[model samples]
Target: MTMKGLYNSFMYAARAHAKWEIETSFNIIKNRKQLLILFIMALPLLIPAMAHAADFIGGKSAFGPSFFSPTTFYGSIAVGVVAGLITGCIGAGGGFVITPALMSLGVKGILAVGTDMFHIFAKAIMGTTLHKKMGNVHAGLAIAFLIGSGLGVTGGGMINRALFNYNPVMSDLLISSVYVILLGFLGFFALSEYIGMRKKSPKGGDAHGGPDEMTALGAKLQSINLAPMIKFDEHVVPGGRRISGIFVAICGSVTGFLASILGVGGGFVTFPMFVYGLGISTGTTVGTDILQIIFTAGYGSIAQYAIYGYVFYTLAMGMLLGSLFGIQVGAITTKVVPGTQIKAFYALAILAGFVNRLFALPEKLAQMNYITLVPSTAAIITKIGVWLFFGLVSIFAFWIIGTFIANIPKLRAESGYDVEDTKGGVSQ
Candidate 1:
């Protein structure tokens, strides 16, 4: 496919995934049951606090050493807030930056990945109401997909663990390399899209518009009448479409593998693969993606990472809490910000993450002896990457929060709420 076509596909997928995440965040916070469950899950962390503040902050005990330093605790929340802001404002998946941000904050690459997975799982469990959306789900298709995803998760987890056991540097190298490849393509395209939009429309409207059409590849895939065909979209298409279960399973495997290795929950890619590759209708794709993410994230985090002790429950909970608030504020701020600016910031944020991971490579390479370099010089480069990444994200977060605060009166007026009356505790 052409670069522009690829970018469009990517954005479509990301927006769909972001929509789910935003909804999930809202649901988790709004529902008392979910809030109670979340609180219960977090109670164990407080047990450490009873001993001594210092004892809880990276202290060792019979159970294990805590990774609960104040810096890391608050830092993880900051990371989640920034990510949530990007997702809410840009209308695209902000999760791409989470693992990179954590790694930059001195988290072990494996631990970062595992913790991210757990965070996603927690969000999915608390926020996703699959029963309400199951009308659009094709049970057979979901089953086939999960079957393949399960195997993929296993393989990916084994690969990461094996690398870590062999050499921690190697594991970091692998994860960083993956991000470099993904973010490099995405960042370059995002920047290009921003420039193109600026030229076409001074004040950009919607970044993506137009109907979702089946791609040529999607058509070809659907034509393959292998046995055990999984039919779907009967509600949208007259006769509905059928694709081989094998192809569906293959797509699931790819999604699961990426989720396992990257901790992104694989929702970003699932939409594109279903809509563009498998010829699935957007309606069906949406519900199925939701169902799958819960399973994929839960299985990957608990079965693959948590059991092995890679998942950081404290960091996961902190991110969950921060993202809930950040998404709401960022979503509100979108009413005040221009689409062009939002798109531009999204591109810059992604490119910042790209630069961060890309520059950190030298240090990993030097440690692994893959490249000879002065240790001090390598450290400096790594520090530059970390500072640049965090600096850009922090600025974006502040800008969004500032915009939200400044626009409260306007937003309230638009919502037909009297600002003066609210100050007096009246709702006239």
Candidate 2:
């Protein structure tokens, strides 16, 4: 009789435990669902803030709305989705898209850049998580780059402030002009690179470098006995010793300074540096560069927020959500598409964006011409042309969205969509 009683007690305890477990799980799931809903609700507020600010909203509040329209949220959504799709295909941050989209809306350049940095931080983390799992991201390399870029950020910021404080108007104009020129130059190079690469046969052999070659350039630089040598395990250099301390510092400083001064993430410049200067394989360079950028930009975002208060949380949040989806899609597309063709395509897209920015030569001419009626007509024509171009872009934009939705099934069929199966898989 006593033993029977003990068995009943044991069963009762087991049942109680199972019930508790079920309730806990249900609560956790319920919380997650609520959070997701909140995040979704926040999207509208965030995307516009990132893309164009209130200026994009067609309201009169210091910033005037030219490109940003209250009527065009749907249009921005369409553009954002398409941009996400394209970035996913190319394996890159969609800033190239977001910046232009925001600029089109007449967002102040500084605010657009500050807000974009916030979005990039979130997107980079997402990409890093997935890539790390696939053995693509090098955490050690990331840390090393951070060490260098962290310092660069400070240096760049100081330089920027010094210039602005000394002469705000002249400094601003010079900086913007330089950015336009740089974009123009890079665009040309990208075009050339695209044309040359595209003409190559589709059946070309894989060009990923050998492990020994990964740090050959860095190793050679080590002979100089430069102070502050950082050791990191790079992708191609399998044995945990590649990239000298000095080289990392140099690279970091350059990237940070450029990013801070120009309000850019510096991936375009750093991407090539890793491949050509450091002699890292293309794939390793990209992964490592992103990891490094996350740290650099993460710091920059915080700093910019504190300094300028220029960030529109709404814009940052929206871009983050959009980018989260975009990066995943772009990373996935990298697997099925050939890298060569994608490279050609992305290069062309960047070039196009650069040209759009460079097209402001008339405004410069007007500024020189004393803003007279003759120049006023020129400015008006330019503005109209800008609108017309984006109008045409909207059509292609829809086509891109349709294409992405259409490919969902194919994306699912191909396992591990993050792989850079294509010739030019995404470049952040």
Candidate 1, lDDT over the whole model:
0.83
Q: Which stretches of candidate 1 lie over 4 Å from their true place?
A: 45-68, 202-213, 417-428
List the global CA lDDT of all models. 0.83, 0.52
Residues 189-293, model 2: lDDT tens digits: 546655766786535543222233535454566455555544544433555444566676678788887776665566655654555466555555556654556
TM-score of each: 0.90, 0.67
| C-alpha RMSD of candidate 2 | 15.9
Report the lDDT tens digits of candidate 1 across residue range 332-355.
889899988898889889989999
Error of 1 at 253 (Å): 0.5
Task: Pick out the ten consecutive residues of candidate 2 with the lowest summed lDDT.
Answer: 13-22
Clashing pairs in 1: none
Q: In angstroms, give how far residue 125 of model 1 lies from its true place.
A: 1.1
